[model samples]
Target: MPETLPAPCAPEDARRVACIGAGVIGGGWAAHFLARGYDVTAWDPAPDAEEKLRRLVAAAWPALEQIGLAEGAAPNRLTVAGTLAEAVADADFVQESAPEKLELKRSLLAELTAATRPGVVIASSTSGYPMTDMQTAAGDAARLVVGHPFNPPYLIPLVEVVGGERTDRAAVTWASRFYEVAGKSVLTMDRELPGFIANRLQEALWREALHMVANGEASVADIDASITEGPGLRWAFMGPCLTFALAGGEGGMAHMLDHFGPSLKSPWTRLEAPELDRALRDAMVEGCAEAAGDRSYADLVAARDQGVIDVLRATGRLGGTTR
Candidate 1:
């Protein structure tokens, strides 16, 4: 048997969490941990990272307040560590949101593994790479798992949790429970799947969008509308499966699948991805800019945050959230 390190405290019982990397995702995670009333220690190598991270948490605080902050939640609880070792030395749970580079992740996790006390659960905010590939370099791979979150993770409820081949089932369970206690909706996966569940579906949708834009088959505005004005509304309360299940009227998924399964042979969707050549990339960027119109990026972010909060309230997921 591989040597097991001493186990850390249960996630629900954890008081301090470590966030490795302080870019958008990492900073969002820091905001989340702070909102959940945990003392968060964050480490980042970039210049001005401490300043940037604090600003991010500050920006996210209003939205978090709307979502209802935990009793003791406060931004003053965050600490920026000068070194990776210093950040995670006493963390009960460690969340790594480092850059997606394979080698960086490999070395970072290994470093974290060495520095963190035994039994502490470590999770990566990796969007796609399977944990198996990333765990080889870790000193204790059994305690590492992926805890993928969507953009603007401070308010987004979905968190996909999965373990690598070498990861202990207990760790996976621990991370899932931890995310739940932290007010996230957890999708605990059974096995490793590329992009996991949500991203795989999202990537497929995105690929088709790129194909359309590249071929002049659709404008960015058209594509955005096709979802926002159409399926996106239903998607707030129900997924594509459940939404389509209603398409069969009195029939359920079985009937709906039987009715539309034949359409699977249609060439409507371009499965092959469009290359991100300069021209295509420019077109995508310009199209988005046009779609943004008068709204700046900050304006868009605030609008989106409020929109999500409204959606959560409407869906009864916010537990009586008012505005």
Candidate 2:
């Protein structure tokens, strides 16, 4: 694990936070911070982005309150800034949730780095891009790090802290504490890897799901059920490795590994990654539509959010500090 540092500011002192690119992820970041009692300044160039971000934050509060994550934080704590520099000028932490394009991110980070104070950590919300690219454009490269949060960050607790080659350990440490205090589960990356850990793991399962549908081995609905009803249940409490250990009975992982070793070479195992084709992509969309039945996207998102709240509350992880 990377060294953990103290929070950049005490909970009471964590007031000024800046968010650049108030899109989906940026708006989520703003919600998390504002809901945690921080004064959030959000900036975006899109026409009506400020109003959209405010609406998004407002919509998120009820769900967050339902999950017992929001305390007494008020909506007025959120402020929209006209310029990127103005948003970050007094911020203790600067979060860039801009587009995934490398060039755009580089430009934003450069501006944010120059605007913010010396010790303010600049975290990027890019899903797959490496920090090295952003750091190259940052005025103080040491303060720029990847702080990718899962979707709907105000609801999900996981946040991946990735450090680039030039990143300072102290910056990563401070960032971990900052996120933890904001009600997030922080995972530090040992080294910079594209997609980090969780996304890569998700992609692994997604690849198999797509392949199964493409091969006609299972419909999209069946595959969804296979997970939502099967491994998903076990995964709620124990991860795959631990679940396998229990599967081995008295033998544990070594025993299970020995038994499954032969299957490793089988074609059923996705040992190699497959390229996504147009046909498979279309099949996936169709399968998902079939699985949807009468449920709309909005309904599905609400249901999924409720499920997450239930699981977290049952596990006593909701609004609970791990550290």
Candidate 3:
């Protein structure tokens, strides 16, 4: 491994950012950096990657504009690089959003680390792969970290950042600070957690929902409504743990847990995932199509972006505050 490297610049002072692998997540990251007034260079191997990336950025620019752009933000600031090396040659930070295959990730990170400046931080957008596993192939694992972002990275504020065993503590701290400097809400994790925090919680609920569907208990639409009409409202602002604490009616989390702890043993949730057989697969697809009604994919995306923007504003997050 190369000698431990220092960051080229403070996160706030970073100027050029590289987005490797120009798919949805990669494109979203590019849109985000561009909206924040950073010089963005992106690369992908797909024949039409540049066209698709530009379209995705163009489509997302409106939502970003609604949220408010940095002083010099503009779509014209983006550059599509022809190769991986060219993309990160001068980047102060590199964000890799390649496909989720393990071997592919390992090789890509290794190549990315080799091509990028030794001190530049390289973050993977893998949803669940631990940084420890992904950093194995990197020449300088000290600078590698996992920077998991939600879909439409331009609008979503929460980014989960963590480092592997070989990752430097300073790298983790730098990545977290950089994400904040770029206008993101950061969750700096001490240890690697498979699926990270949010995804693990979501998977649990997702498993139970699938189980209910498999058992003929609840329709997919019902499951969606159960969230949208119920706990989802509270979750938009208050997280589950604190929201449940409110259930104690003044006694708070301690009393609430004491009273409901016994029910934990009840067979209410099926943590194990149900088999995704042909029938279940078809059902899920059909259910979503039905729920989507006549809305096109673009229409749905627009609605989701606007909805998130409204939520952020209502919560006062757009102004970097809360009511």
Candidate 4:
């Protein structure tokens, strides 16, 4: 914390955002910010990063238009800065989407903190790394936080916000409020959890899926079908916990847990991830290729975007802060 750190502006009033890194997650973030009517400045070291980022934002514009944009929101609001320092020079908020290497995160965050305005919050789009580990290199760790989002952040509504050991409690609160203001569903965690909330659940399911695939217990398409055709539908409107609560009929969660708790001892799932050996890797690759059939990457992305839009509409989550 700097002695001269200014009082931060209200999260909802924030207008200009700096996105440091132009990869998929970073670019998706840029698209989301643009859709929310913020002027976004992005910086990436890759030679063609600007071109790719612009293309990504262009591809996502149609879905954004359907979801509804904020006043004056347009894809043209994006600016590809030539350097990271230039990007954050006037940023009201900074979002770092660098690669997942710890050292890279440490150095990049330190640089960002040094470059960004003193009171502006700086967030990382890390999938799992705790802010405590990533904030060590920052000159002022108080304003650094984790703002983890799922892929295609422009569509996903959930963002898990958490602060590290050195992070100021107020900063955590600020980040959470900012995410909600930016039209995202926020899970403001009190303490760091391994993989956060959603990813932890996703990892368990992913591990089980891999184990099944490795053991030839289920085909790739079958596993996908099990979710997309079954629980996934309910999950669109109700979470797994509530969905299970319904299983108890009038008994609610207590009865449901009591009845199902005993069955927890069954060897139903392999929690540990199967080794990504050559055979397993090849199987996963080949299986996905076969499942994809004729759909190109662009086609799949478009299909997914439309599907998410439909689900959001059907569930009545498109209005308000959901989109």
By lDDT, the best candidate is: 3
Per-residue lDDT of 123-181 in model 1, one digit per residue for the tens? 99999999999999987899999999998889889999999998989999999999999
State in Å the error of residue 169, model 3: 0.8
lDDT per residue for candidate 2 within 1-323, as digits (tens), equals 12223335653456688999999999999988887878899999999998899899889889867766455677788889888888888888888898889999888887877777666788999998999867777667777789998898887888999888778887887788788888789998879998899898998888888888999989999988888656786666456664554465545445565576556566874655344445654454455445545766555546555765677566566667462
- Provide backbone clash counts, one per model: 3, 1, 0, 0
Reference-based TM-score, model 4: 0.83
- Candidate 4 lDDT over 160-181, as tens digits, reads 9999998887788888898899
RMSD of each: 11.6, 11.9, 12.0, 12.0
lDDT of each: 0.85, 0.77, 0.86, 0.84
Taking all chains together, each candidate's TM-score versus the true structure is: 0.83, 0.79, 0.84, 0.83
Question: Across residues 1-323, which tens digit of lDDT does each residue of candidate 3 receive?
Answer: 56466898888899999999989999999999999999999999999999999999999999999999999999999999989999999999999999999999999999989898879999999999999999887778999999999998999999999999999989999999999999999999999999999999998899889989999999999999898767786678656654565565445455565576566666777553455455754554455555546766555556555765777677676797757
Model 3 alpha-carbon drift over 4 Å, by segment: 272-323
